[model samples]
Target chain A: MEKKRLYWRICCVAAIILSIITFTPLVIPQGVSKPELGGVPYSLWTSFVITVLLVILTYIGTRVHPGMQNEEEDL
Target chain B: MIFWVWVFGLIYAGLLVFASLRSYKKNRSSEEFMMAGSNIGLTLGVLTFAAALFSTFTFLGMPDFFRINGVAAWIFLAVSDGAMVFLLLWFGYHIRMKVKGMEFRGVAGLISRCYENRLAGYVFFLSSFLFLIPYVGIQIQGIAIFMDAAFPGSFPAWGWSAGIVLIMLIYSEIGGLKAIIFSDAIQGLLLLGVIWIIGWACLSHFGGIGPMFDKIGTVQEDLLSSPGPQGLLTPQFLFASLIAILMIPVTQPQFTTRIVVMKSMKTMQLMAVSLGAFAILVILPTIFIGMYGADLYSEYGRDEFFANAFLYDQPDAVAALAIIGLIAAGLSTTNAQIFALGSELRGLLRGNENSIMTKTKIGIFVFSVIAFFFSIIVIDQLVLLARVSFAGTGIMGPMIILGILSNRKVSPAIIYLSLTGLIIFLLSLGGWIPDMYFDIRLDLILFITLGIAAVISHLTGTKRQLIRPKTKE
Candidate 1:
C-alpha cells in the first residue's frame, strides 16, 4: 500500500514538472528564431511530448494503484 | 449537400429522441433522473466525459485559434487538458472518498456540507453560473453562425440557436441525465469520426503532415512557433490557461458530477487516461485545419474563413457531415452544462425529491433561455469566449481545493475572499477594471493569490483531516 502511495506521489510530481515545462517560456525561448526537429518546431514538439507524458503518467498511476480490487469490491 | 445535411440532421435528431424515450421510463425519481443510475461503466463514462470536454470550441474555435494564434494554441488547450486528466486521478479519489455513501446534490452543495457553511454553495454556484452560461452561449453562437454559413438562408443565426436549445431542452427534460449521457456517447463517436475524416482529407490535400507544416511555415513562419503574430500565447497567458483548464474537473459541476457517478475508482482511473487519449485524437485535426486556414484563408474574415475552410472547400458529403458534427458538438456540451446548473439548483433546494426535480427541470429551461438570449449577443472568437468562461469559473478553484483536501471547518474569510476575487475577475472580464495588473493578466494574478491564500488558511486553521487513505511507510 505504501508503495502504491509513493508511486502516486511520484506520478503527480512528474505531472507538475511536465506542466511547468510545457506552459512556461522555459522550454522554448521567447523569440522569433526557434529550433526545429524534423519539420516541427522544437517548441511545438516539446509540448506535444509533454502531453504524451501526461497520458503515460495516468497509465502508470492506474497500474500502481493497490486498492483497485478493493475499490471494485466496494462498488 | 443541403439534401444530405437535412437527411443526417434528421437522423441525428431521431437518435437523440429515441435515447430520451428509452431513458424516460426509468427516470421516475430525481435520483434516477439526475444521477443516471450512478453505475456508469467505462466505455459510456469515457464517451460522455470526452463529449463534454470537446465541444464546438474544438470543432470551429480551435481551427480559428490555430489560424490566428499559431501552434501555441495546441499547448494552450491540449497540454492543459492532458494535465487535467492527470489531476483527475488524485482529485477523483479524494472527492469520491469524501462523498462516499452520500447522495451528491452538486459540487457546490458538497462543499457547503463539508465547510459547514451554506454560503460556500452559493458562491460556488454563482461562479459556475457566471462562467458556464456564457460558455454555453458561445457554443450555441458558434454553431449557429457556422450553420448559417454552411447552408445559407436555411435559418437565421438566432433561429438556429433557438432550435438547438429547444431540442436539447425537450430531450433533457424527458430523459434527464441518462438521455444526456447516451446522446453524449453518440455525439462523441460522431465528433471523433468526422474530425479524423476531415483531418485526413486536409492532410492528403496538402500531401501529409510534414509537407503541410512545411508549406505553412513558409507562408506564415510565425505560426510554426509560439506567440505567433498576435502574441496571444505568451508564457503568462498559457500558464494561466493551464491553471484554469486544470480546475475544470475540480470546480466544474458537470465534470465533478461525472467523476462522482463513476462505477468504481478503476473506471475513473481508466476513464482519465482514455479522456487524455481522446483529447489528443480530437485536437490533432484542428491543428491541420487551422494550418490550412493560415495557408489559404489569410485575407478572409472569421465567418468567411470558417465557411471556406469547413464547408465551401469540402466535398458535398463531408460538408454535410461537418454540419451534423458541429451540431452534435454544440448540443452535447450545452446540454451537460445547463443540466449541471439544474442539478446544482436541485442540490441547493430544501424540498422533497419530486418538487426539487420539477423545479430543477424548470431551472434548466430558464437557464437555456438565458443562454439562447446570450448566444445572440456573443459574436465571433469562440475559443477566447470559452477560455474566459474557464478562467471565470476558475476563481473558485482554491475554495474547492481547500474543501476537498481538508476536513476542517473552513474559515468564512476564505469564502469572502473567494467571492471578492470572483467579482473582480468578472469586472475585469467585462472591462470595468483593467484586465492586467503590473503587466500580468488579472486572472493569473487572482489565481495565484487565491491559491496561496487557500494553502495558508488550510495549514493554519482548524486541522481536521477527514480523508486518510491507508498509508504505511
Candidate 2:
C-alpha cells in the first residue's frame, strides 16, 4: 500500500507538470519575442525542457524502491 | 537507380535469417524463447521498446503528416513518450509482480488467469489477434511501398513484400523474441542516424530553422498554433488521445510481453526512462523533416507533396538512403508484430506448456500468411484503418485495467459494462447513430457508458464478490 501511494503521488506530480506544459501557451501572450530554434516554437521548447526535467526527477524518485535491490537475483 | 540500396537490403535480410536460426538453437525452453530466460537488462529492453514504438508509421506516415500539417505532427512524440512513462509508473510494477515467478505464455493468459475467467482470456486473445493483423499488414505494405519507391524499376512491389516477409520469418522462426530484439536494436540506431541526416540536410537547404518557419508563417498561421486546424485537437480529442496512448501498452499483447521479459523491476524502470529519451530524440527529427517537407511543398503543388517534394528531384543517393531507412523502420516493427501474434496464437492453440521452438516456427508460418493476404486485400485507406483499429482497442482497455486492479477476478457486471462500452464505440464508429445527440462527440458517449459501468460495478458490490479471495485447502 505504501508503494501504491508513492506510485500515485509520482503520477499526480508528473500529470500536473505535463498539464502545465501543454497548456502554457494558452496563458502566455503572443507579443513576446520567444526565439524559435530549429523551426520549433519557443513555448514548445520550454514545455519539452520541463517535461525532460520531470522525467528525470520521476526516474530518480521511483528507483528508491527496496525491491530494486534484488536485481541480480532475477538473472 | 541506387544499386547499393538493394545490396544493403539484401545483406540486412541475410543477417536477420542467420540471427533467427541462432536464436532457435539457443532457445532450450519456452521461458528462454518467450521471455529471454527473464534475463534481459536495460540496454536491450530499452532498445526493443523504442523500436517497437517507432514503426513504419513514424517513418512513412509522419513525414506525410509533417508535409501536410507542419510542426503540429510533433504532438505524437510527446504522446508516445508520455504514454510510456505513464504506463511504467502506473502499471509496470504490478505487472512484474503478477508474472514474477510464472511463465506467462501471452498477455491474454496473464490477464485471464488474474481475472479467473477463461472466457475473458479467450476473448482478449481473439481481439488482440484480430486487431493486430491489420497493423502487421500495414507494416508489410509500408515496406513494399518504400522498396517500390526507392528501386523504381528493379524490384517490383510483390518482390519487396516477399523479401521482407522471408527475412522476418527466418529470424522470427529461429530466434523468437531474442533475435527480434537484437536486430531491432541495430535497426533502431540506423533509423536514428538516417532521420538526423535528413533533418540536417533539410535545414542546410532551407538556410536554417527560423527562415523556414518565416516562410511557413506567410502561408498557414494555424499550422504554427497549438490547437491546429479545425481544432482537430480539441480538448476532448486531446483527452481521448491521451487515454488511448496510455491504454495502448497495457492492451497491446506485444508490449505486455516486454514486461514479462525483463529480469527485474529496476530494469523495467531503466528501460522506461531510456526508451522515453530515445523515442523523443528520434521523433523530433521526423517532425522537423515533416515541417521542412511541408515548406518545400507549399511552393510545389500539395498533390506531389511528401515523396516528390522531399525526394522527387534529389540525387539518387539521398533518396535511396531515405527509402532504406523507411523500409528498415517498417520491417523492424512488422517483424515484432508477427512474432507477437505468433506467440499469442501458439499459447492459445497448444497451451503455455508447449515447446517454444516448434510453436514459434508454426506461428511464423501462420502470421506471415495472414499478413501477406491482409496486405494485399485491404484496400481501404491505411491511416483510417489504423485509427479504427486503435479505437477498437480502447473498448478493451477498461476491462483490462479493471481486471488488473481487481486482482484478475473481474465481476461479471464489469464484464457487462465493458461489453456495453464496446457496443457504444462500435455504434459511433459505424455511423449507426449521429455523434451529436445534443452536440457531444460519440467518443464521449462511449466514455460515459464506461463511467456508468464503473459506478454500477462499484455500487452493487460487484468487485467485492468477483474478486473475493479463494480459501486454501
Candidate 3:
C-alpha cells in the first residue's frame, strides 16, 4: 500500500509537470507554426500529445492509487 | 428535410420516453428518486458526465470558437479537459472517502457537513444558481436560434425555448435523476454520432489533413498558430481557463453528485479516464468542422455559419439528424444543470422526505422557468458566456476542496473568504470592477488567494475527534 502511494505521488507529479509544460513556448510557441507534423501546426500537435499523455497518466494513477482498497471495502 | 426531421425526431422522442419510463418507480425512496439509488455503472457514468460537460457549448460553441480564435481554442478546451480528468482521479478519491457510508447529499450539503456550517452550503448553492442558470439559459437560446433557422417563420425562438423547457420538466419530474442519466447517455451517443457525420462531411471537402492546413495557411496563416487574428488565446488566458475547468468537478454540484453516485470508486475512476478519451474524440472533430468553416464561411455571422455548415450544407437525413442531435445535446445539459440546482436546494432544505421531494420538484420547475426567461434575453458568444459561468462557480473551489479534504476542523473564515471572492468575481463580470490589475486577471488572482487561504486554514485548524453517529448531537 505504501509503495502504491509512492507510485501514485509520482504519477501526480508527472501529470502536474506535463500541465505546466504545456503553457511554455516549447509547446505553444507564439506566432510560430513551423516544425509541423503531417500538416498539423506546432501548438496543436504538441498540446495534442500532452493531452493524450495526461489521460494515460490518469489511467496509471487509477491503477496505483492508494485509497482504492479502502474505497472498495466501503463499497 | 422536414420529412427526415419527423422520422428522426419521432425515433428520438420514443427513446426518451423509454428511458424515463424505465427509470420511474412508484413509492420510491427519496434516496432512490434523488440519487439514482447510488448505483450508476461505467457506460452510463461516462456518457452522463460527457453529456453534461460538453453541451451546446461544444456542439455549437467550439466550431465557432476555433473558426474565430484559431487552433489555440484546442488548448483552451481540449487540453484543459485532459488535465481536468487527471484532477478528477485525485479529487474523486478524497471526496468519495469523505462521503463514504453517509447519505450522499449534493456538494453543497456534503461540504456543509465537512465544514460543520450551514452558510457554507448556502454560499455554494448561491454561486451554482447564479452561474448555472444563465449558462442553461444560453444553451436553450442556442437550440431556439438553431430551430428558428431550421424552420423560419414557423414559430418564434421563445416558443421553441418554452417547448424545450416543458419537455425537460415532464420527463425529469416523472423519473428524477435516473431518468436524467439515461437521457444523458442517449444524448452522448447521438452527439458523438451527429458531430462525426457532419465533421466527416466537412473534412471530405478539404481532401486530407495536410491539404486542410495548407489551405488554411493561405486563407489566414494566423489560424494555424497561437494568438490568431484577434490576438486572444494567450498563454495567460489558456492557463486561467485550465484552472477554472479543473475546478469543474470540485465546484459543480451536478458532476460532484455523479462522482458520488457511481456504483463504486473503481467505476468512478475508470469513468474519469474514459471521459478524457471521449473528450478528445468529441473535440477533435470540431477542429475539422471549424477548419471547414474558416475555409468556407470566414465572413459569415455566427448564425449564418451554423445554418450553412450544420443544416443547408448537409444531406436531408444528416441535417435532420443534426436538428435532433442538437436538441438532445442542449436538453441533456440544461436539464442536468437545472436538476442539479434542485438537488442542491434539497440539500439545504430541512423537512420530511416527501415534502422535500415536492419542494425540490417545485424548485426545479421554478429554475426552468427562469432559465426560459433568460434564454429570450441572453445574448453573447456561447463559448465566452460558458467560460464566465465556469470561472464564476470556480470561485468556490478552494472552499470546497478544503472542506472535503482537510481532516482538521477548519475555521469558518474560508467560507466568508469564498463569499467575498464570489462577489468580486460577479462584480468584475458585471464590469463594475476591472477584470485585470497589474496585468493579471482578477479571476486568476482570486483563485490563487482563496487557494492559499484554504491551505492556511487547514494548517491552523484543530484536529477532528470522531464521535459515533448514534452518540452525535
- In model 1, residue pairs whose N, Cα or C atoms come closer than 3 Å (at least 3 residues apart or on different chains), thus clashing, are none
Residues B1-473 of candidate 1: C-alpha lDDT, one tens digit per residue: 98989899899989998999888974377888899978788998999999998999999889889999888888999999999998898888889877777778899889888778999999999999998998899899988888888878978889999999999999998898999999999999999999887878777878877788789878988888788889888888899999999999988899999998888888888999999999999999998888888889987888898888878889998999999999999999999999999999988899677887779888999999999999999775888888888888888989998987876665777799999999998787778999998899899999999999898888777766465445321
Error of 1 at B40 (Å): 0.8
Number of the candidate with higher DockQ, 2 or 3: 3
List candidate 1 segments past 4 Å from native: A24-26, A32-34, A66-75, B464-473
The ten-residue window of minimal lDDT in model 2 chain B covers: B464-473
Q: Candidate 1 DockQ category? A: medium
Winner by lDDT between candidate 2 and candidate 1: 1
Off by over 4 Å in 2: A1-11, A20-39, A64-75, B153-156, B298-306, B313-315, B350-364, B379-385, B435-438, B444-448, B451-473
* Ranking of all predicted structures according to lDDT, beginning with the best and ending with the worst: 3, 1, 2
Query: Which numbered prediction scores highest in lDDT against the true structure?
Result: 3
For candidate 2, report its TM-score: 0.86
**Overall lDDT per candidate, in order of appearance:** 0.87, 0.64, 0.93
Shares of reference contacts reproduced by the candidates, in order, are: 0.57, 0.17, 0.75
